[model samples]
Target: MTTTSHSNRDLRDEIRDYWSDRAATFDNDPGHKISAGAELFAWANLFRRHLGAANGRSLLDLASGTGEIALLCKELGFAVTGLDWAEPMLERARSKAPEVTFLQADAERTMLPDASFDVIVTRHLVWTLIDPKAAFAEWRRLLKPGGKILIVDGDFVSRNWLTRMIERFSGSTSHGMVSRHQDIVARVYFNRGARSEAVASLLLEAGFENLRIDNRLSAIHRAQAHLFSWRKSLLRRSEHRYAISASAPMTTKE
Candidate 1:
C-alpha cells in the first residue's frame, strides 16, 4: 500500500473504517479491557496515583474506544468526555458508560473550546496519528492552565529481523486491528522511531511543560505478558509501551 496513491482523506477514512469494524470485538480483547477484578483495581490505582484528586476535574479521553479509560475516570469521580472519530466505537462506549459524554470528533482537529479540560488521556492512539505534532498542539489547546495530558503509547513497528519474524508468526494467531493493517502500520510516522525524548520535545514545542515518562504501566504490562500478548502477536505491535505526562503552563491573569 503506497501512501502516495492515497489522499489524506482516503487514509483517514481507511483508519476510521478499520477502527469501526473492530469496535464490536474491541473490549473482548484482554489487553483492551479490564475484565478481572485484580486488573481493574490495579489500573484504578494507577490512575489515582497519577491523576491525583479527580473531584471536579474535567477529563477528555481522546480516542476513547469502548469507554475504557473514560468510564474509569467517571468512576473515579471526574467529569468525563470520551472522544473518537469512529461512530461504532463511540456507540459501544456510550452503551457502556452512558453517564459520560461521548463525542465523535477527530483527535487531531477537535473543534472544542480551548482550555476546556483539566486532564486529557489517550491510550494506544499516538501511533495511528497522521500528524502527531499537530495532534499534540491540538491537545495542548484543549487543556486548561496547569492541565495535564497523559499518553500511553510505544514504538510498534521499528524492530530487528528476529522481532519481525516473531511478529509475523504471532500476528497469524491474532485478529486485532494492527494485524489487519500492516500496510498502514508501516507508513505511520510514529512507528518509525517515536522515542520518549522525541515525544517530550514535541509536547514542549506544543507549549506543554513538566514532561515526565512513567514506566510503571510498562512494568505492569511486562509482568502480565499474556494480558498484552495479542499486541505482540500483531504484525504491527509495539515491543514496549509507556505512559507520558505533560502539563499545560498555568495562565497568568492580569
Candidate 2:
C-alpha cells in the first residue's frame, strides 16, 4: 500500500535511514537489549501474560531491531521470523541469533502470506507508522484466525513537564544521538505521539477484537530501574508507556 505520511510526503526512506544509522549503537539502551537478568525475566513474564504458551507457534516480529524481542520469543519456544527494513539492524540481529530467521522488509507491508502466523508482536514501532490503519489491517491479514497481536510502545514525543525535567536532569534517549532522529520523529504519523488510547481506537477500526490496553509496564520498568537515575526513574514512571493486546476475529468480518 502507498503510505501517506503526516506531511503528505513519503518519509519511509528517511525513517529507514535514521534507524539504519543507529543500528550500531541501538543496543546501548538498557531497555533495547535483553541479555540476561531481571530484565529478561520481566520481559518474559510480560510476554507469557499476553501470549500464553508459545508451544512452537509461528510468530512474527515487526521492525525487529537487533532481534531482542525476536530472540526473546525464540527463547520462549516460538518459531520466530523477524522483519526489518534496515539491513544494519538485521545484520546485528542475525549475529545475535543466527538460528532465528531475520528478513529485511518493511513492517507496514511485509509482503508475506495471509494467515501466516499465530502471533504478531512489535515494540517501539507503532508510533513510527506512516499509515497505522493500513499497517494494522495488514497485520490482521498476516495473522491466523483467533491470532493475537502485542504492541509495546510509548508516547515519547508528548512528555509532561515533570518527565521533561527528569530527562533534563538525567540523560534522555536523545543523548549521544544524531539530529536526524528528531527529524524523522517530526515527520512520522504519530509526530505528537498520540498515546495508547489512539492506538486502541485504530485497532478497533481495523476490525481487531478482544482489545486491551495496559498502561502499567511496572515489571519491565522495575527490571531496568538500575539503568536510570532516581529522576530518570520518576520520568520513566511519568512516561506514557503501554501495551495493547488484541486478537484477530475468530471468523472473517464483512
Per-residue lDDT for 1-254 in model 2, tens only? 25534344447787788789889989996678875888899899889988899999999999999999999999999999999999999999999989999999889989999999999999999999988999999999999999999999999898878876775676445644546777778877799995999999999999999998987689889888888667767877788899899999998579
Candidate whose lDDT is highest = 2
Any idea what lDDT model 1 has?
0.80
**Which portions of model 2 show Cα errors greater than 4 Å?**
1-10, 170-178, 252-254
Q: Pick the candidate with the highest TM-score.
A: 2
Off by over 4 Å in 1: 1-6, 171-180, 222-238
Clashing pairs in 2: none
Q: Please give me the total number of clashing residue pairs in predicted model 2.
A: 0
